[model samples]
Target: MALLDIKGIDVSYGKSLTVKNCSIALDPAKICSVVGESGSGKTTVIRAVLGLLPGGGSVTAGDIVYENRSLLKLSKGEWRSLRGRDISMIFQDSGAMMNQTRLIGKSFVEYIRTHESISKQDAWKKGAEMLGRMRLPDPDRIMNSYPFQLSGGMRQRVGIAMGMTYQPRLLLADEPTSALDVTTQAQIVRQMMELRDEYGTSIIIVTHDIGVAAYMADHVVVMKDGRIEDQGERGYILNDSTNAYTRKLIKAVPSLGGKRYV
Candidate 1:
């Protein structure tokens, strides 16, 4: 069985349905990308996977089975337990999700303690280790500083490090590189790939950039207006697309070969 099986899911905001019979399965040790424009329900798919949909919004119909467990039936407490330990998410805006006043090290240490029965000192050590793994220079200093003190790329790295701290079986990234420059974006993508290589973690990345999806995803799902436009392997989507929407998306990105021979 797949690590995460989402079958025939329909999400509704009030009486109106936003997502219509969406379905995708994610395997362990692989990366899947969900690409679509804003308001296309791509983010909603990931939110439902994480069980973080808004209060009024509900899963009108679906089954989210993670590790053979039915996530749709899980209680709030049970979902909370699964969140950080079994699954984690790295958001687009790192600071928005973080405590403004707390230092990175202090917050990370506390987060580790909550998930595992570890001493504060040990948690600090582990947090520093993860920051180092993300190639954060002077890890100690970055950890000691608050979220505001770091640049957008630096804060995003910290967010990624924290999410991977427990080696979650599933990792969700929501527009992770949107706030970064091109160079920084490339670096972050490489780091995330390395994380999967090292830990064998399953990943679901939601983004608008097809280039990023091409570089990072084993499988790609294209979404439009709350429905799936196309879903397939990267090679197939890049080389042979039957859908017009998917074709336009692929063509919109600039080529990296310095000259457009095509």
Candidate 2:
């Protein structure tokens, strides 16, 4: 059975229908990438699954199921229990999402305590260990620093470390690398792939970069104007898809010296 299934969901922001009849099924340990231009509703789909829709936004129809349970029917208390332990999310700019006034260690420790019953000292040690696993040097010093003290790459790694703390069954990343430089982007992408390999975590990544999608996803879903324009296995979407929009996006990928990156 699929680890997560989104069935014919229509999402709305107040009266405006933003996502229509979207469906996706992700199996255990698989990576699925949703690619689309801005406002195409790719982010909206994942946000709905995580129940993090904006204040006025909501899933108006159909259902989201995770591990045989209906996520749409979960209560606030149930969702609180499920979010950090079973499913975690990494945002576009993790540093920006953090409280700048607080030290990174403080935020991380609080985050850990929220999902697990642990003392402050134990949580701090665990958080440092996770940061070390993500390859950040001198994890102890990192814990003492504030988010702004670290570079963009470092901040993103910290986000990944926190998200992977519980070894969640599913991870949702929304344009997680968009705010970083090329080298940082590559590092973050590689790290995410490594997490999947190490923990067998299923991932759903939302990105506008088709090249990244092709490189990281087992399945590629192309969205346009609030609907899925095309979807299939990576090879099919990359080489065999006849959909005009999909073809156009693929062709738009940058090439250097006659070699296309994807």
Using lDDT, give the best candidate's number: 2
lDDT (Cα, tens digit) per residue for candidate 2, span 4-118:
9999999999999999999999999999999999999999999999999999999999999999999999999999999988999999988988899999999999999999899
Candidate 1, residue 204: the lDDT equals: 97
What does the lDDT read for residue 148 in candidate 2? Answer: 96
TM per prediction: 0.95, 0.97
Pick by TM-score: which candidate is best? 2
Q: In model 1, which regions exceed 4 Å deviation?
A: 257-262
Give the poorly placed runs of model 2, Cα more than 4 Å off.
259-262
Query: Residues 67-177, candidate 1, lDDT per residue (tens digit)?
Result: 889998999889878998889999998877989999989999989988789889999999999889778899999888989999998899999989988899999999999
- Candidate 1 at residue 12, lDDT? 96
Clashing pairs in 2: none
lDDT of each: 0.91, 0.94
Q: Model 2 TM-score?
A: 0.97
Clash counts for all predictions: 0, 0
